[model samples]
Target: MEYVPVWIAIGLVIGVVGKLAMPGRDPGGFIVTILLGIAGALLAGFACRAADIGGDGGLAIHGAAAVGAAVLLILYRLVMWSRTR
Candidate 1:
């Protein structure tokens, strides 16, 4: 799709922001980071849609995505931590 590249770029930026917010050694590499970001956006988008919040390219949607990314990052850390325990 035409939006794939734009999504990836946004994802990468969101992913980097998530990583920065939760500073530590990443268990996975770049691809995982990118996936996390993309997934975060998707999660937020869906939730917003369900809540009747349209994505009007505003700060609210972006902020939700960031929070989603941070949440996923935390979950990822917990999973990896449990596996190593």
Candidate 2:
């Protein structure tokens, strides 16, 4: 079996961890959470590469990306809440 890329693995971890970090009523289910985490990882990768803040083997980049993803998800939930009210 082929191993998943480090970046992908990192992204998945970030996504799962990030979601867990955020508390509250999140719309959707487990799949949604997984998607959010993976999406966050991807976003983090792109952001880091674009800003040239990657490749240092530091947790900062990964953490930042997770935070970013969580922030986006929270915003999404808030918007949804507003629209429903």
Candidate 3:
């Protein structure tokens, strides 16, 4: 709802950072990275809501989103790599 915009912005930043974090061929290119980042943010935001980890928006949420995005990028890389094998 209200958080959608924030998530998109965060995703854009995290996706760019994730690209640098994961240096290699992206099977789906930048678009995929951006999508993964958005998914990561959504996942983190939901998890935070469920866990009540951090009340409302804050830096903690952004940090969590970054970690989530990184993990997703790694997973995406592994999956794409394994498919080639």
Candidate 4:
């Protein structure tokens, strides 16, 4: 239960930051932000598990996760845009 709020807050922050990080005409709201954040967390965990690096200390864990998520989101947007055309 305690983790829920923590995750929510983290999600909001990540979403807002993500929005700011990639400028210009992204369409989304609170729900979209939450989804993006969740996706980010999931991607992070998956990468960690696949690489077998989460068990040990890594200087780039958080950075890698954020970057990975941002990349995914960007790709998503691009695909959506292309499809709409």
Candidate 5:
């Protein structure tokens, strides 16, 4: 519901940051970026829940999400690079 827009905004921010953090050519475009961001956040959330690390909201969660997004982007690049060789 109301959280949808908030999630999208978070996703956009995470996506842009992920791109800037790992500058260079990659796959897909804006849509893919958004999806990556959202997926990363979701992944972080699930990990945190499984680990019982933190509550539903906190700086740690947000930081983890950002890191997760960057990691995903980096992995994607690595895979693509390997595939080309």
Candidate 6:
């Protein structure tokens, strides 16, 4: 409830970082970026919660989130490439 904004901020940061970290140009626009970030954050939060990596801090931006975002970006690229080829 109260953590919605936090999650959005975290997502935005993670998404931007993920996009920047990835090599070469990626597709999509602002909405896609936002969605990617939100999804990445959610994935990381869930994984961390399941693995108990960050204690009980709920969903926040951290190493796991960054990694998750990167992973998502990589997967996105792979899928896009596969579709093109």
The candidate that wins on TM-score is: 3
Deviation from native of the Cα of residue 83 in model 1, angstroms: 0.9
Best of the two (1, 2) by lDDT: 1
| Candidates' C-alpha lDDT | 0.67, 0.62, 0.77, 0.59, 0.66, 0.67
Worst 10 residues of 3 by lDDT: 1-10
Ranking according to TM-score, highest score first: 3, 5, 1, 6, 2, 4
- Write the candidate numbers in order of decreasing lDDT: 3, 1, 6, 5, 2, 4
True-structure Cα RMSD, model 3? 1.9
Q: Which residues of candidate 2, in runs, are more than 4 Å off?
A: 1-27
For model 5, residues 6-75, the per-residue Cα lDDT tens digits are 4445656888777677666666666677688877766765676568665655667666666776677667
Model 4 C-alpha lDDT per residue in residues 1-84, reported as the tens digit of each score: 223344344455676776666655546644575578767755764566568764543445555555656666667667766876
lDDT of 3 at 33: 90
Model 4 error, position 63 (Å): 1.4
Judge candidate 3 at residue 49 and give its lDDT: 64
Candidate 3 off by > 4 Å: 20-24
Candidate 6 has what TM-score? Answer: 0.65
- lDDT (Cα, tens digit) per residue for candidate 3, span 7-62: 66787788888777777775788888989988888788668767887678677776
Report the lDDT tens digits of candidate 2 across residue range 1-83: 12124445665675566567765565665567667666766676667766877466466676666676666566666776797
Give lDDT for model 5: 0.66
User: For candidate 5, what is the total of clashing residue pairs?
Assistant: 0
| Residue 85 local lDDT, model 6 | 77
TM-score, every prediction: 0.67, 0.62, 0.79, 0.60, 0.69, 0.65
Clashing pairs in 5: none
